[model samples]
Target: MSVESSAHTAAPRRVVIENCAIATVDARDTEYTSGHLVVAGNRIESLGSGPAPAGLEHVARRIDGTGHLVTPGLVNTHHHFYQWITRGLAQDRNLFDWLVTLYPLWAGIDDEMCYAAAQGSAAALLRSGCTTSTDHAYVFPKGGGDILGAEIRALAELGMRFQPTRGSMDLGESHGGLPPDTCVEDTDAALAATAEAIDRWHDPSFDSMLRVTAAPCSPFSVTRELLRGAAELARAKGVRLHTHGAETVEEEAFCREKFGMGPTDYLESVGWLGEDVWMAHCVHLNDSDITKFAATGTGVAHCPSSNARVAAGIARVPDLLAAGVPVGLGVDGAASNESGELGAELRNALLIARLRGGPAALTVRQSLRLGTMGGAKVLGREHEIGSLEPGKLADLAMWRLDGVSHAGLADPVAALVLGAAAPLTLLLVNGREVVEQGALSRVDEEEIARNVTRAVTRLHGG
Candidate 1:
């Protein structure tokens, strides 16, 4: 929908939250032990130390944020919303093996399944303090019936700021690709459909709640022609490009054997490396590959738990950061990372980085940045939704740190990142309340659960 069509006609709505610890996650990493934030309409009006300035009028809401920590709402840079219903299906497999096991079931998915899955995924993300999320949905069953639109409706109903890619796979098992023939699309058909989705759904306005991306699934599942074509189409349409790359050893081997080069090199050959592109996983990138990624301004969507779940080696996150590559945290697919908690990913990324590069590999604030500002940079929305600054979108999370799990922490940021997943006192997306008092405000959780149960049963042929 166009921004004008969906614009609110009501008078300006303002909310004030005080007595909270604010971590801006800006370039300077500004922090205030006791701060006040003002949200006017859909943007942050002002935020700084101490109470809000007096004489504020027409206040819509005033929150006593005692013992709470406020930060930018987490941004999930990569996900497969369609995989929510299929969680735990391939529990004991590597990346390739897991896809092989799940392909046939995925090939049978239709619009109904995708809507339920998208709802479930959005619910999990919001409960975990995620406001904006990008979905990489590549499996397009021929008779699925507008799967992308189904997911778009589901997320919009839940008030999620969404950037969903019209992902496609042109190379199938018949062509030595990973996905089955039924799950892949014709190269030209996929490109045309992607352009159609972009024209119909993409809104380039600054406060747009929905944007479209063009993504060809992966090296092993998409032909070189499709990759180059997708990149060209994305640039022409002013949308970003996303895909899976360097995710596992098997994928690296596949690229080397088939394309006579590494995954990074193959991507560069197809014009896939650029500021407009962000690749997921990237766990197997070598030093030279990291150099190219930095030089080309490419981004990485780091998925620590998913990599660990599939036994994919730890990505060199510290080295990647040192090389000036934009790295963001991702929950990945629920089928692989069943928790689907973007909040927990902050800690997971920290622990994994330390495991790979020692105690000081990643700081608590750095991990938080990965989920907030870094993610915004990767998705090219840094100026819009990454920090708690005036003129930016009021997409922020208020974590209740006074509870048993986080009280007396002294450092709110550390409590949020190193401690247990804190419950959100409130979650705001575009100055609108999505999660209030730790529950979704717009949709019933019980209803979402029931829908997911039904969808899963249907997918299982029950």
Candidate 2:
């Protein structure tokens, strides 16, 4: 499938996916059997099964999505875009061994590599039906590099909504942290960069293009003081705080050994339990921790593919969702999952939940919901971009399902999860098409693969 087709119409025009079976996921009449989705000026004007509103005749361009799965653009709550260059190298290793083997390679990253990796990952994600992504780029590697700016620029070119965390790895092995000293940072520099990112990018408005969350890498990679300070700094700036917590049994052991407490206990002591916080992985949480997270409105980014890849236990996603935990989907990192596709995460999430909680435990709708609305809840952007209502941003994905795998399916929604990735025909972010016909609309994706290939060769001595 080539993406160089006519894009349904000419550019600099009002685009509409007309006669599509619109699935708004809104409160009333959410599913439109066959209707028009008018994207006049970056927002859905009116979507329903019946005729359009009074004067919708002025749509300049229209693409028909009659046999497609249309929904709110999927949100990626967690990711390390830079890791796309280093995937599959440290295979069969647990978290500690995994980090140990990869840290050296990661220490060599510059802004160019970060930009290329983020562009590649963002293209892959959009091709898999994701429209918005939040990247956790915590590894600065003590260089004169601008990784965040590179990634932000790439995403801006792609027209994806970006929420990057000013992540820091302050505590080195000398300080009982996981990263080496080269990858660690001084406390003052870390805090300064955090403030700089927030001041430059953090947008509190509803139609924000990019936002910065102060992220200390994890419990094992940061100090208690750094964690508390990051939280305070985030609160002062009104941004979010993110980190890793209880991702594996080994992490649990590390926390108990280092802090004399579990991961949740250490986080709670550091005032990390709050509505403005969300953690990645979260595979080894206890019952009490679940309760605390739910009560405090803390969110979790559930990464089934990454957990299973490193042999981390399958997170009790069922229990977490049942316990009122705001659970969202994450690919974690390409190094762990080897696949950064957000729709791939949906498939893994659905299957893994069913494996643990039986067939009725997770449905296709629920899985897709997790990637969209659930992710928005985790990011506190639910009211803005999760659904396909009129007021929401026109961030959406259209997966064509006319293939044999989905041809005979009675319901499009059911076919979406079970179908063979459904073949993304178009992905829109803020009414702009970033991907068309399963390829990036802007940068050369094949060139990205070639660059990453060369980068990997340099990374591990070819």
Candidate 3:
């Protein structure tokens, strides 16, 4: 089954998907072989087996899902969309060295570069079955004007559900931080800009296309004062908080030497270890830290590919899950992971979990949950867009099982995670199709690639 076109229209506000295998990642983890789902006005109206609803039969748009596998659209809990411009550069470096090498180039980013990079990255994610993502754009060059705003505009054009974090790094080398002075910002200016972004873009309603989070880049690059202030401001404004935590042993040593405690302790001292916060790359944490996270409802975004690429240690995903901590998958940054494909991230997650524990450490269903429902839980969006229920948003991905990769797979749903990554036949967010026939419908892929290449050339001075 394939969608005819990717044209954006509201004429057919209702759609019925008939005769597909549905993996509903709901509370019960339900699965149906010959299921039917109805989408009406940006929300799922109903779903079951045998027949469509009475009124949905007359809907204009009907997608024949004879040989397709449908599931909730995957959610990416953490990313740096602008890093798509720097893929394959600094390939052999560790975390600290990679950041130092790329900071200067990132300082050269302008409004156009941000737009192109965000568009390209979002396009890649859509093709890989991600309908919702959180972009951590923390670099604020000295003279760059509203780079976050440009990123938001570009993502909107792609029709993706975006959470653009107002990320900051106010501690520079002059202040004993990793980033240079030109790459950091004044604390007052950063706070004000964050508030402005929240006021201008954040919509806390159901099925909102855009939301904002306050993220101070990381422990070594930001000040303790900024962390405390950002958390207070986010809570006062009713937004979420995010940052990098416990990613490396070197980072743990730095936190201990600088703050007189471990990463998790420092986070608590700054009043950031709470339910409204989610941290990226928690690859190193003590047993106590895991207990604290489970107790406080803190979330972790696991970036398996980036961790392996940088020689960072494997994260304790099975332990975290057993402890009842909310854990989600993340494609940290295109430069580090070298791929913004969320489906590939899902596969890496399964392999890495089994590598650390045993073959039974992570199942295909569990990994799929981490990419979908677990991600929604991380972002506090489980109520709206995680599963395919009657009241949930119409965000879904359809993969055709007719391809060679899945030719003889007996279980199509399991093949999606255990088999090779496959292109999405159709991707819908808020009842609007963004990808159709294995291509982005709203944006021209070739044009986005060309613009991103031009931006990278300009930044590299070639």
Candidate 4:
């Protein structure tokens, strides 16, 4: 396949990495104790055991991957990138109380603030071995000034594959929603903006670096009309749908009181459950809800740390997996998950599943899969970006396992998911290095940190 070049003059370059432990995360759970992977342009040319074949032609860069474990880069299924600058607020509050406190604060956001926050969020994700991420950006202030555009620009600059939803919340506090009036939009206007975003940014190519989704914020924060409209818009435009659902018991109660149904049922009523739809949380899903999700091919973005931080109950992840519902890990937003590292969610998902369903609930490899293949499935990119197979997008993480954090584990996957977040040796998105030596390669970390500080100061009126 031909790759796009910046100057539109040269063909794509090829790179090789040898002497690493490769965990393909493929259908058969393939692994190589020592192997070599060749990347030609934005696709994996080939990968197999032992040294690379002699006289590999036209090599541009070669990396010695000793003491590293290479896996398909972790994919983040849900996040609020704008939440990076607004972390630490509403710490002691549940979902409802937290939104009540932060809605006004978030309402002041603009393009400048979103660009800075998105960079900070992407920086954290890149360093933590995440190469692909889907952001649910719903809080569009009236004069937000290209909020979605800002996010798209920031991630594009950083060279990470992005799927950002044009999310909307039309139900304000007056309408029994959690958000303040200023943070919500009109139903028709929201739908129009969502469609506009897709036209402007969504790329559906096999090696697509950016795609757009239509997201109505959540069951409690959106009107039933907005939910139905968003689903229709996304399907008509051939884009996926995303939203928050079943996040907490309070949300369940809100749905029951207002819509006379549970969150899942309300979603299904509005045509929001399908292969193209993936909901965040699903923390309060019942057995029937799980069955519905599986039967309809609805996916879930399991945000374990954020759920725990907000006192949301443990999600029935093991049960969902058993019922054949696709499950993926999410760092959520930085406000609820301050670390904002997708790599850590691998460990958190494992522990949370085991906490709810005992020791055998989720294995280390399963945890890694949740962050990789499962996430790819949720976002409808499974065939293109999930695994490290030939012809797949060359998006993968080279994790360093020789450090103090993970030196002695026999199984590299064990040290990765069961232990603390393993530091990345490199992170590749579309065969381009977004991160190297655990730092962003395309931008300066210090510059990103400074921008975040400025954005925070502006947001807080400091």
Write down the lDDT of every candidate, Cα atoms only: 0.93, 0.84, 0.90, 0.92
Residues 17-49, candidate 3: write the lDDT tens digits.
888889999999998888889888789989988
TM-score of 2: 0.94
* TM-score, model 1 to reference: 0.97
- Which sections of candidate 3 miss by over 4 Å? 2-12, 54-58
Alpha-carbon lDDT of model 2: 0.84
Total residue pair clashes for candidate 2: 0
Point out the higher-scoring one by TM-score: 2 or 4: 4
Kindly list the per-residue Cα lDDT of model 2 for residues 333-360, writing each as its tens digit: 9999787888888888989988888998
Cα lDDT tens digits, model 4, 8-120, are: 32456777888999999999999999999999899999999999888766677778888889999999999999999999999999998998888899999999999999999
The collision pairs in model 4 are none
Q: Write the per-residue lDDT of candidate 1 for residues 261-297, one digit (tens) a residue.
A: 9899999999999999999999999899999999999
For each of the candidates, the C-alpha root-mean-square deviation to the true structure, in angstroms, is 3.8, 2.8, 2.0, 3.2
Clashes of 3: 0
How many clashing residue pairs are found in candidate 4? 0
TM-score of 3: 0.97
Lowest lDDT 10-mer window, candidate 1?
1-10
